[model samples]
Target: MSHSLSMPASCRASLRTSFAMSGALVATALLLPLTAHADQQSSETPAASGETASYDTTDESPRSAYLSDWYNQNVTVIGSKDIRFGPQKIDDIYLEYEFFGRKGPLDLYGYIDMPKFFGIGNAADSGAFDGGSPIFAEIKPRLSLNELSGRDLSLGPISEWYLAANWIYDWGHNSDNRQNTLYTGLGTDIDTGSPLGMSFNFYGKYQWENYGAENENSWDGYRAQLEYNYPLASFDNGASLFYAGFTNYDFGSDLGDGDSTRTNEAVVATNAFVYSFTHLRFLAVARYFHNGGQWNDGSELNFGDGDFRVRSTGWGYYLGVGWQF
Candidate 1:
């Protein structure tokens, strides 16, 4: 027998109301620092002097420098369903938290994804014992080689280069279902200088993975990404915006077992519409995925009875809210 689950009307309405209130709080938080800065500027301005004051361009205030580096940092909380988008679906609610920021020159980005606090649905339907309960975390830190070397590596369109490393951990419902992965890569950042401020990234990565089960895998791959954002319209309090990105990955044959069948390839695309208030952002996102080869999940290789059957393609949607600091 098969079954389906859906959120009730009242629960969805309550979630919508909570999101509205959260957005208002985020806006207030974002405005307070600006308001303080404005007040400080007003108090510091010289009183009605006959002579005009000249500004110094070389010297920058400590507060201004700090704010420049940290003001745009943000954390987003999202509620999503069927994040994996599969033939075997995880129908329960899931919460994801993402963070993006900079610590000095190194750029940091990561997300934590897990099911809701309370578990719902039957054990078999939830994949409780099969390593499909969906708990994953990843962190990537990229060090700018150009900045560290104090040299410009720009070659026509490429603007910056970096040495990147990433660590990922995945946990299934049981202790026997776990995987850890590490990746080191060379990457470049490109600025297109277009009307939409489009950007691109290229990466050549070597990946190593260890699964709790018998089989393990390693491979080399290259990834390409394109990203852009546009402002659609403005309102008295906020603005509507559109953002989109695409990513492609190509991997070589498995290094450990020398099996071409164990290699993986994938392409993913995402689009979102965001509404921005004083300090908060609300967004709706749609994503598409195309997968091929034995490691279709992009993390580990799965072997079936006598062949590989992991290839899949699907789409999913998410609604989220973010607070900028």
Candidate 2:
């Protein structure tokens, strides 16, 4: 268990909330489709005179268009360490259900995870079935401005713009530990001209029920996030390797309430390597935290047994295996 520092904020006592969605590991695939049936082959028909005639189906329309344009779902088993939630550093194994895709003009990503569900964790952890937060989930959705407006809004390297939103929830036992947060703002994808893919988002945060922190029920902060991905290699057996990562900067918060141990800014960056096939996937991530969860690094706190230095700035890691469906 983490030692507590002096604070009037109940959140600092046992904060377990996590920014799960911002750390989503999925990378979007960009498909530039010009004409829908451009790849279809022409069919041959026998004529009355026994000659063959060929006809193209390019003029034909799709029999049906699905509301969910494209999607992928997976169940992942993840082992993570030193994921800061406040003053505490969490280490646990979790089961997660993650999904991402596009539907009409909306792009989406989401996940629901059960922390410590397998009964493996540090002393600070509580199993999902053993009084811990039963579920933690985050959902992110972005509406495409170009698709909605029926116009080419592309400007040079920027391919698209979006109205984006992110929502997070942790189902703790009571109000004191539960967290609800929402971020809304703008997002955009950039065309890098090579194999690299990139996206950026800026958001204003709305805090709610944040473990009784002083910033709860208020607009407390802003976050800027950048995501990137590139394909590394491919195999003849249909397996592929890739690199993906994201960086998040959170600032402008009053959660510290004047405490030096807590601050208004935090930074988290992740680097991931993935190997994926038709039905199986594996990934490893190295994530760095600076003032993680806004808890100041190198700050001294008394865990009731004297003074201990907080190591909020460090590297954390995650290893996961998943099955795609």
Candidate 3:
């Protein structure tokens, strides 16, 4: 019981809502599918060659063609799904989504995994266009429920079509406490050439206690960077490839004794490689991070404003994994 109050109200509400809704949605979705077979069985579906039938059965008719087309033309639908998230990166859908297009089956096709890499062709090379530098478009719907994580609703056509974009403003009864956030940004991927993929992104990121964390913790900062990493035949199976990004960080106030680490810069360097396991479907990213900061972790540093103190340097490594559905 002591631990209950320590958790924010938003967390509790989300928990209860998810528990109730998840079960209901799953049951309703599964129920409709189960009755499909029974309906077909009760229909005038053609009987086996040797069996007697109750309804007229004709071939080469419009009705027959319709049913045949419905059955034969495969409906390959990779559905929009609900994924539950937890604290650990294992459940961080945003991070996973960010990297999924590269390793997933639609791999290199459905996702743009590179930026500023000329490994693939542009829209003009597809022969679908007869002019200089053909322009293309693609649109997608971004959906999420609840008032806290994002806007109650957002539907707009972004300028870049091959990629979908969003501007999320979430609020709720307990919103400003933990997740008092205001952010706007765009994200999307483009075709590099053909099999090669490219992803481009631009966003101004900031956070206020990230609705799920403790009340006083907040994240307010702006970061701008680009990432370029793809298959490099210059190396073995793209091993020992390089990905570099430079972005700045400006921490916010109202942190309640939290470090006033703002107006600082961070440079990103990673030498990553991939391992394929046909036995078990999983993609792992082994990245070494060289974080360049004026003040880093485990360093003797000082905050320069009126001798207010802070540390501004750090270096570390992180492991991220992606598994097939």
Candidate 4:
């Protein structure tokens, strides 16, 4: 006795229409700030007499200013399916919400990842009730040191530097297991001036079990990540094409065993192509995950097992739409 759930055609049609309308509204909102800023800049007149205007000039370019103060605020909704290949093939659907914004000199970014399993009868009866819950939630805040110091540190391609911090929480699908992670580090934003913008970050992390005995002791680790986005083309209709990607590497000091005290735990990479239309953006993403040392041993499913034990690579794809204001 199994049951399944499927979305009705009417519901899907309604959702599509709602998204289109929302995109139009969001695009208008995003453009308003730019229009106002442009007007302000154009209206700037010479200072009266010998007096000098005290306009802020910390940011190097008008585009950067707009991004930091206005264009950075965005909300994205993504639907993705993850396929795990092993003796027991597992596939799951996830809905994700991502937000990025700025408050004064502080930049905030976060996401909620929710996993859902349809076509499964009652979740409670199938022991899959937890599928509707959030699988992970992370929030990261960064403080711009250069801006706060009231100095323009634009050297070469490097435009600004910041202090970054992250808080992450993870939950198990059907268990009380929970984990919390704290990260702090340094980061920089780079302006390539060639449609490609880059960012680099290095962080130290501390992880501990929040409610489960699965993780007995706390662990310390270090991570480095590089991210970039490039605009490929633009059309007169306000549509554009872009490429974006990120790579992350993690090293853990306490996850090793026996005589080994440090090990490379994981490396993850993602590449995406984005099609932008005014205030709406659609993205297709491809990702790869590599696990080693303690990570590979503990998360065996991620590395495969039995006949698929030799498979050490995992991949996933994502499709998403974003709205900005």
Candidate 5:
């Protein structure tokens, strides 16, 4: 049966609210390629002989101390469906403009997405021209603590520390369809002593306008994230095969209202494979969501006709073709 027809009206409304607030995660999938590329390139760049290591003295160095900078911009088409996080699943296809870079003390990543760009989705979807939110964007920035303090705070196996923040915004026509969220905390890059690169971050979440969800306008949960990137292979033509991914675990949130349908914890993990070159790229991603959007798995929502079981745990897939600039 169609989710639109089978879902109770109230549950449907809650589902919309949850999906609107959580849509920022969709933009997150766009981050892997650029992040992996930037890190890989920076790591492979040759350093000058006798260069002062970043972990040297506590003296405040110039803004260009490290002297390595890299960035990439790309546009991609992405599609996914049947990944549940609410009363039903949301199917969406979006056009994405993404950018990421590292310069001086800053590491930054961001993207903008136009949902339903191809006018393909289920009834729950709001097309770009339709009443749904037209644009969703997310920005993540990390400032090196070592750079800012002019000190090398690297511990064993930890190469760098950062003050990291993420902000998400959805430009919808009304407050009920809009979302604004922030995550702030500490982050670090790990030294694996091999080709594999890893990063970890922990954040406290603050919710602003969450599509009228109960958690709106308050401090909500905490999230722990881990990311990894590896260069699987490189070709003579400069095209390369790369593997990258991230995992997020969210906990300690109280959405108010206290409905049995929702929980305080959720998790999502994603893996990506990219075949990239200077001018073009191809990407495939697989993701797993458990208790997505904090919706309880196997919980029943009772309405007029019968009870419907929520399906919030499952696998989601994304495919994209991109042009790098």
Candidate 6:
């Protein structure tokens, strides 16, 4: 009995030691990535360096400043959907959600961002614009329809190469309407947050000839941009500012009558407001995009059947507030 009792104590000691070793190994394992990110966040770009870093916080919520990325890496599948609210406008309403699983040095995730929904003013089909007007009386059912989108691996902590595309066509809610768009791209993370950590994204979108056939609006274009983020103390939220310059090269013969290359420049003012109840975040963004050699004044405004169909420069902007999980 004495010998058996001694063996149990020995086994317990071995188990305890194993657990201790396991903990130390885990802590050691976590150290590498943390150092990697700090190296980016703590310093500015070296005079000899070229680009910023690509990485987000991976620690789960209940986040603290000590947590890497400040816990921005969402292990949950969170995203949003949006649609046009009126004619002459490209935004309507949006939504978001999230999912979970964890991988090594990375978290598994998925998301969606849609920008169109149904409404009585023929939101999805017509060039219906409120024209800075107000609706006094309403008797119809305010219509609404949601859209779906897959995750954009274009920018995240654990993304490799990303590819995405979307095309939309709906005529049920209005008349003489045609619209289609396609988008896809590749990106990488550059961890240079120190002096000016910026990320690079090269994406292309093919918007078809809408309500016109002169190839007046068909083009294969890509946007190359850099973004910078800053954390402010005012709201327990981070305030990030960014600027992106985009260009599109036309493919069809419309260039014969107009410009062939289109350019867009934009600046961003942003803040992600976290809520106390549902734990969801509200993202407020303001951006201004200018289309070089593009006219948005005719029936063919941006894609309308107007005179500026040939690549000409035009300008517009949007202030949006949406949520993410």
Q: What is candidate 5's lDDT per residue for 66-178, written digit by digit as tens?
A: 22224545678777667564656678777887665556777666677787889988875775688777787777777889899999899999888988787878887889778
Off by over 4 Å in 4: 1-77, 81-90, 117-128, 154-156, 173-176, 210-219, 258-263, 292-294, 297-312, 322-325
lDDT of 1: 0.39
Any idea how many clashes model 2 has?
A: 0
How much is 203 displaced in model 6, in angstroms?
Answer: 4.1
For model 6, what is the alpha-carbon lDDT of residue 138? 8
Instruction: Pick the winner on lDDT between candidates 1 and 5.
Output: 5
Ranking by TM-score: 2, 5, 4, 1, 6, 3
Candidate achieving higher TM-score, 4 or 5: 5
For every candidate structure, what is the RMSD over all alpha carbons to the true structure, in angstroms?
Answer: 11.9, 11.2, 20.8, 12.7, 10.9, 19.5
Error of 3 at 175 (Å): 12
> What C-alpha lDDT, on a 0 to 100 scale, does residue 121 get in candidate 3?
31
What local lDDT does model 6 show for residue 142? Answer: 8
| Residue 142 in candidate 2, Cα distance off native in Å | 0.4
In model 6, the Cα lDDT at residue 50 comes to: 26
Question: Candidate 3 on 282-303: residue-level lDDT in tens?
Answer: 1222222222222232333332
Estimated TM-score for each candidate:
0.62, 0.79, 0.32, 0.63, 0.78, 0.37
Q: Give each model's whole-structure lDDT.
A: 0.39, 0.60, 0.21, 0.43, 0.61, 0.23
lDDT of 2 by residue, 1-325 (tens): 1100000000100010101112254321100000111112123333222322121223463221212224545677878787665566778888777665455676666677788989998876775678878887777778889999999999998887888887778888989878888999988777778756567788999988877667889999999977765557654444556566677799988866678888898987766676655446677777777988788888888857777778888887777787654
Instruction: List model 6 lDDT by residue over 32-120, tens digit each.
Output: 01112222232232211122222222444234222233122211111222211112333333221222122222221222222222222
The residue pairs in collision within model 2 are none
Give residue 277's lDDT in candidate 6 (0 to 100): 11
| Best lDDT among the predictions, by candidate number | 5
For candidate 6, what is the TM-score?
0.37
